[model samples]
Target: MRIVVPIKDNSGLESEVCEHFGRARYFVFIDVEDGKVKGSEVIEVPFKEHEPGDLPAFIKEHGGEVVLAYGMGRRAIAYFNTMGIEAITGASGRVKDLVEALLKGALKVDPEWRSKGDFGRHEF
Candidate 1:
């Protein structure tokens, strides 16, 4: 399976995960199989600035099966769901640590947060 994690830097996955999905500078795509990291790469977001849907579509093109983000807007979350890709938000800590937690089933997605709209700004 392929998982994408929004990262602040590509420094061996030890840096903190990005807090905002739309504003993340890079996304580290990791390929895993049987709870093991097979391969990975950092995909740069094009155009310096992008809409949420655009990033999701870029992820789709890269064979992403899941997304591990810190926080994301409701519209982007809905778009990911419509694409049948799993999105786990409200994540923090290092990218590699989060990935390990997910592989070990130690991480839990907060559905309440995911279902909320507009990062608590507007209603969906």
Candidate 2:
């Protein structure tokens, strides 16, 4: 499975998950198979400016099967869903750790915790 996580930097597996999905500086792509992470890569968000639905398509283009992030607006999540990508929000901590927890079926996402707003500024 290919899991994409919005991160704050280019630290690979050690990268901290970004608070806001659309505004994240980098995205970590984790490849997992047999319940183990095969490898990962970090890349910068490609566009200088984007609209509400752009990032989801970008993720899809890059073959993202799931999006693990701290916060993401409803519209973006809907877009991801339409594209068949699972948008798992309310995630935090190190990128690798989150992936591990997810694989272990321990990652919990509170559906009630919707992102406060959009355009890269989300309330906690």
Candidate 3:
């Protein structure tokens, strides 16, 4: 499976998972099979700014099957869902650890996640 993780830096597997999915500076593309990681590639966010569907479209173009992020707004998650990509929000820690947890089925998805101010914002 191909997983996309929004990150703060280019540390590869050690990269810190960015708190906000839409505003992340970098992204790590990981390929896993048989419960083991096969390879990974990192890329910078393509645009200076983005709208609701851009990131999800980008992920689809790259053949991503899953998204791992600490937090994401409802619209973004909906977009991913529309594209047939699984958005696993409320994820944290290093990219490697998250991948391991995914393979182990240890990550949780909180359907009611929301920011402090309103349901419109994304707060990690």
Give the root-mean-square deviation of each candidate in angstroms: 3.9, 2.8, 2.8
In order, candidate lDDTs are: 0.79, 0.84, 0.83
Give the candidate order by descending TM-score: 2, 3, 1
TM-score of 3: 0.88
Candidate 3 residues 42-93, lDDT tens each?
Answer: 9887787777788899899998999988778789889999899998877778
- Candidate 3: where are CA atoms >4 Å away? 108-113, 116-124
Q: TM-score for each prediction? A: 0.84, 0.89, 0.88
Give me the displacement of residue 21 in model 1, in angstroms: 0.5
lDDT of 1: 0.79
Off by over 4 Å in 2: 110-112, 115-124
The count of residue-pair clashes in candidate 2 stands at 0
Tens digit per residue, CA lDDT, model 2, 1-124: 9999999889989989887897886898999999999988888888767787888888888889999997787789889989999999888898888999999999976554564545344322
lDDT of 1 by residue, 50-111 (tens): 65588789889989999998778878889899998898987878888889999999986555
| Candidate 1 least-lDDT 10 residues | 115-124
Top candidate (TM-score): 2
Q: What's the residue-level lDDT of 45 in candidate 1?
A: 73
> Which scores better on lDDT, 1 or 3?
3
Q: Report the alpha-carbon TM-score of model 1 versus the true structure.
A: 0.84
